[model samples]
Structures are given as C-alpha cells and as structure tokens.
Target: MRTSAREVAVTAELNLSQVRALEVLLEEGHFGRAAQRLHVTPSAMTQSINRLERDLGVRLVNRTRHPVVATPAGQRFMHQAVRALEASRAAVEAARGVGAGLLTIGFIDGYSQAESRLLDRFHSENPDVRAEYRQLHWEDQVAALVDGAVDVSFARPPHSGVDTRLLDTRVVTVEPRVAVLAQHSALAQRESLTLDEIDELEVVTSATAPAEWTRWWVIDPRPSGQAVRYGPAVSTIHEAVASVRTAADSGSGHVLITGESVGQRASNAGVVFVPLVDAEPCRIELCTRRSDHRPAVQMLRALADAACSARAKTGRSVQRGAEPGVGVK
Candidate 1:
C-alpha cells in the first residue's frame, strides 16, 4: 500500500539544518569536509547524521570507510533529496519572479514624472517586457524588492538586504518640510513656511514611511507624534497622501516632508512646501535587487547608465519632460 498522506506529512517535517548537512555530506562524501562545508564542527556534523539515522531508522552510510559511501537506500534517498531541494529552490526563484513578468517597478511619487522618462526608454527597447509603476514610500520600495513584489525600485539609500547597483544621483537643496493642506485650511494662507515655524503643528503622516520624516523632519517637539498617535497604519503612499489631505481639510495643521520633486506637487495643490535651509541636501539613489540577473533588468540598468552617462557627457541636468517615451503600466 502507498504511504498515507498523514504519515508522509509526519516524515517530511525534516530539519532544514539537518537536511542541509545531509546535502553537504552526500556531496562531500566525507564527514570532516562536510562539516567544513556546512561551517559546523565535526561533532555537530556527527550529531546531525545521528539524528537523521534515528529519524529514518536506517544506516545511510558505510561508516567504516574513510570517505563514506552511501548505502543503496541512502544513495536513492540522496538522489531524491537533491531533486527535492532543486525543485523547491526553483519554486522559490519562480515565486520571487512574480513581479518579474513585466518588471513590476516602483518609484517615489514626487519623482514619477522624471522616472517615467527613464522608463520610456526601457519600454522602447524591450517592448515585450511589461511595466508597472506604483508610487511607494521609501521603505516599502525596499521591502517590495526583497519579496519580489517590485522588480526594480528607485529611492535614497541605504537600501538594505537586496542587491543594489547605483544609478544617477543628485543632492538637491534641503528646504523646509512642507505642510500639504487641502483646498480649505486656516493655515493655507502662506505660500511658503519654514520647518521651525510649523514645528508645533499636528502632522498627518503614514505608518509606512520612515520615522525620520515625521521625527527629524517635522518641527514638532513630539517627533514621534505620528507613530504614538496613529500607530502602524497605511499600506501605500497614496493612503498617506490622502491622510495628510484629510487631516489638513479638517482644520488640523498637518505637515509632511518634501523634497524639490514633492515640493512642486504640494505647491501646485495650494499647499506650502517649506524648506529647511540648514538641513542636509536629500541624496537620491537608483536601486535594484543584487540577485536579479534577468535580461530585461540588465537592459534597463544599461539604459539608465547610458542616460546618466549622456547627462554627464553633456554636463546638463536630465529633465523628465525631455524623456520622450517612458511608460510604466
């Protein structure tokens, strides 16, 4: 009779570390080297092997030999183990490629216009490659890259975990963090304001964004006001923007951090994006996963580099308006 599903489930609950050791042992054919390969002590390796033997109730190796040889059952198991591991690994890779189909890409909302320019070239070159453009907070952009939700991301560093290759970056002036108000607000009078001037205001912010925006950027003494007041909340940048807009419309003075790119957006909305003259200039970076080695990704990277080089060669700033045909789905 075939093994029951429950029995198989019970047996298949193998220790990841032990399975790793078994893989190393099968590959190395020696206990000492297998231990070295696994970066574990020989005693630990022995214990691992012992556990496997106990679990399976079988002798997997001819232990008397200096270089161990798998028993017939052990050999068969090793082959099956290899196939299982490979299949699982492939599955993980494929899952990670979920965003890989069209290179689900993300960009900061403030810089969407500029980003679209760069992406236009990508689409032109790889017409078959799908493109997705979602506005993401800085931290979410990094997280999405790790989970493979977004294939490529643009932001300021340091981008943690994923493999990142730098693209063009510029240090724009640090102005006051702006107050983005709705069409109707009491403090909407001033076209511009400084960070210190608005420090005491109750700011609207997303739980998704980095704390630095509310803490360091806001003028309020209770820098952690957003987190303490609102707690962890917000799934996207759009939600955060909406929150700010709502809070402003409700007569509560709400402020948000903004750079030159975002400053324009806020200004256009009848909101004042104030600048902090003493603040450090914001640094921008183009980031991508280090592990990603796809043809489309590589091509986009090349195009970005070329665009940067062209800008450097001409000693001119690259403008989004100048980007002829960048597209992101």
Candidate 2:
C-alpha cells in the first residue's frame, strides 16, 4: 500500500484536466454533461477518470446508470478537491486584482436572524461572491473587525477606525422580560407589572452584564439601579427563552427578560409580556463595516439599508392605522 506522502504526491501529480472532469462529474451528475463542460468527448472524460482512479487506487465514480453518483469516500474526496481548486483559482485572481479575497463577516448573535436573511438576498444578486458569517459576542464583534480577523461586521455603534455605515436600526421597547409563570405564581395576574414586583424572582439575560447593560441602556433606557437580577446567565437568546419556559413550566421560577419582538416569535409558547413602567430607552441601530470596501460588502450594506427602509415603512403603515382619522377601506 502507498504511504500518505506517496498518496499526496500522486494527488499533486493529477492534472487540472482530471480535477475539472471530476468536478463537473460531481456537479452535473451526468457523464455527458461533464464531457461537454470540459470540451472533451465522453471517451476522453472516461479515460481521465479512469486515470485518476488508477492513480488514487480508489473508485471515484459510481458508473451505475444514465446519471452518475460518487461513493461516500469519493464524495468526501471530491468536496476537498473542489474546494482546493476554488481556493487556488481565488489565489490567482487575488494576485491579479487588489481586492478579491474572501470576505469574513461577523455579527452579534441575536442580530444574525435578520442580517442572515439580508445576506441571502445579497447572495442571490451577486452569485460570484464569497463570504462567511460568524456569530460573535458584541464586544468581540467590534474587536474582530478591528484586528482584521473579519473583513466586515454587523454591529451597533461606538465602533471606530473603520469606515462605518448604518445597517438595520430598530426601535425596541424595553419591558420586564416577564416570565410567563405557572398559573399559581403570585405575580402572574397583575394587569401591569413593575420591575419592583419581580425583583425577588430569578431572572436571565442573553449575555454578560456589560454587553446586556450596553444594549439595555443604549437601546432601552432603564433606571441605573433598576436592572433585574439574573438567576442563570446564558449566552444565546434561545437558551434564555428556553430556560425561562422550562423554569415556568416546572413551577420553579417566575421571571425572565427578552426583547419586544418575542411576541411575534413566541405566540404559541404560552408566555406573557409585561412592560416595565421604569424601562425607558426604546430603539437600537446596527452598523456595518466601514473600512474595507469590497463589492460584496457594498452589496450587503445596500441590502441592510433596504431592509431598514422596509421596516420603517412597515412601522409607518402601522402607525397610520392606529391614527384616529385614518382607516383602510
């Protein structure tokens, strides 16, 4: 059997023709189309694949029917081969152009759902672009952008040094992230609950104190001394919500905190929201990368702006509906 080094040498010796043939075979799933893509006859494509299999001593293609399939091992190897080839091509393009490398984007966790949808729309418009997203803590999100670990980020302001543009900014009401407790909880029936009512109940926050405080104070103003006491701190919104629900269902807890948007998200979850009369601030803005100007980044920024405008128009429509003299026929 060949040693790993020998196998590496053999793979290295496999020509671009063989790689292209395999790539097209994997993509088109038919030998005829693979041959057409490579501008070679079907027999030539077959010879190339046969040569590759002979060199690797592995069956790369399952030649069963009109359409072809790769064995499990073949699929794994083909995936790596395609990625390597794409990276190699990108390297060549980067050498020719000043700004053509992959754009690594970072975002705060809770904000990803909205930003990700925008990114999807952007990708559909610009199919040739390559990008990545990492969910990062708010503080670390900005630092990642600064350190060049990430090319772009969706963040809230106080971000400096890089060129900055506003992405999607939303006005959110801060209320007691009230726990929808068991029917037996003493505070459950209060028509309007104040922060003081649940002061003794266990609470939860999506992130650390500093991050949560930044968002709460900047986005939703609350009295400095009126912050809720957390019981078990969690790193994600889902985790926090789940913790609250579990605690409530088990009759072990009576309090939690979340954003105003939770109503739309948790309609069937049996949770009730109580606005904290003391909760003050009501809006937050998301900012995008400022410094590195890549085409994909610009596309993302534009998508964000569009999403923000759409959200604003939606808010206006709702407000108009609520106005006394305005009615939709």
Show the lowest summed lDDT stretch of 10 residues, model 2.
320-329
Highest-TM-score candidate: 1
How do the residues 1-329 of candidate 1 rate in per-residue lDDT, one tens digit apiece? 97776675457434545655776676556899778646789999999888877676677788887667788878777666655554454366567655346667777665634455677767886788777777776556565654445667776443432222212222211122344555565545665654444455555554544444344333323333333233224544445456566665665655555455665653444454444443333434455655555677777667666665665566654432121110000
**How would you encode candidate 2's per-residue C-alpha lDDT over 1-329 as one tens digit per residue?**
64696875467445656876786686557788668646789999899889887777788889984468788868877766765554554454355445644667675544434655776787788777677778776445554554345656655433322212212222211112333343446665766666556666666654533444444422222344454454666665556556666777776774555434443354336455555554432222333334334566566666755665666666631121111110000
TM-score of 2: 0.47
Which candidate has the top score in lDDT?
Answer: 1
Q: Look at candidate 2 and tell me the lDDT of residue 287.
A: 39
**CA lDDT, every prediction?**
0.54, 0.53
Model 2 spans with C-alpha error above 4 angstroms: 1-101, 108-116, 156-197, 206-227, 245-254, 260-286, 314-329
What is the Cα-based lDDT of residue 255 in candidate 1?
51
| Model 2 lDDT on a 0 to 1 scale | 0.53
TM-score of each: 0.51, 0.47
Mark the regions of model 1 whose C-alpha exceeds 4 Å error after superposition: 1-101, 107-111, 132-139, 158-179, 182-192, 210-251, 263-278, 307-329
